[model samples]
Target: MIIIDAGHGGVDPGANGHGVTEKDWTLEVSLHQYHFLRKLGIQCKVTRDRDVLLTPERRAALVKQSGAKVCISNHYNAGGGSGAEVIQSIYSKSKLAKQAADALMAAGMPVRRVFSRKGTAGDYYYMHRLTGSVETIIVEYGFLDSAIDMKKLSIRSFRLQLAEEAALAAVKYSRGVENSLYVVQSGAYYAKDKAEKLCEELKQKGYEAFVRRMN
Candidate 1:
């Protein structure tokens, strides 16, 4: 089973920018992903389904108790960065993190990076360090402080798409299907010229890239 965590709620509103709170956004995406997984017959659980508070310790305890293999902690970025990011434990491999990043990229979100951070003890985040053996992934969907990100995050459909794509990635990884084939697209563009421009850039970097029209 997978555990979905909506980061920061109740008293902790998390980052606030452009009139949106990080807690609400995280919860929205988590709820969407929870239902999507359920509909697909995938066993999953959410940390919080409403605007209630969950201490970091409490959240970690729930994840450990659930005996879940994977825990996806969803949070929105802030402090002025563009694109999405996936953070994994320093002890784990980047396979799952890469999958999550790729899913966000496919959903028209630029991926900043997929990497691990270390604390003095173990993993930098409590979700990773305190969650026992569960592979916890912290997904920063987009930066609320970034105009580029806000343009997309402001759209409800776009936010839902991010949640759905992330859920699909979690399902694939948690099921032990790590070798699934994936299309590596840099980003989606409205203008054909812009798409071609990015395609050329990738090709220059020794990547065999092409621009494909999405119907």
Candidate 2:
């Protein structure tokens, strides 16, 4: 199962967004991601089903209870900042976190770098203390107040793009088996070129490789 948490809700309008509230946007994106994942046969559970106040602890408990392999906490950070930032569990070196973070980066999510805060930063976020080794990521997806970002969020097409990136990261990170798998991405550009180059390099290393283009 994959646990999706839409941060802050109800009367608590986390980071007011011009006329839009962070709570509302968070729920919207979270639901979008959850439904998309479910449609693809991935199990999903949310921390808050509707608008309501929930402490970080309660949210974390929900993640733990869901028996999720990964917890994706969706949120819109405040303070008039912009760009995407994902907080991964302290296992920064873990291949799972590396794959997820790299996927997001390669997909061009506006992020500086993925960081580990568990047991180091304040534990109130709940994502900090995990009952298991579940790979978790709390993504603060741009600022609601930023004019540039708000303009993008105003479009459903744009939000769906974000969800796509999240989905891409989830699949890549969760499935590490080396096999014949093709990731559908925007035309044969960076990823395509990279894959082609890797295939050639693998051949040099005495392994057959091929590049499959997506339609």
Best by lDDT: 1
Number of clashing pairs, model 2?
Answer: 0
Clashes of each: 0, 0
Model 2, span 1-215: residue lDDT tens: 77788888887778877677888888888887777676555678788878999876667777777877777777776676777777766644555555555555565556645666634444334575753556677777677778866776667666666765675566556665433235433224456667777777866996544454433
Candidate 1 error regions (>4 Å): 178-215
Provide the overall lDDT of each model, using Cα atoms, as 2-decimal numbers: 0.89, 0.67
In candidate 1, what residue range of length 10 has the lowest lDDT sum?
Answer: 206-215
User: Over the stretch 88-157, how does candidate 1's per-residue lDDT look in tens digits?
Assistant: 9998878889999998998899999898988899888999999998888999999998999999899988
Clashing pairs in 2: none
TM-score of each: 0.82, 0.72
15, model 1: CA deviation in Å? Answer: 0.7
**Worst lDDT 10-window in candidate 2:** 178-187
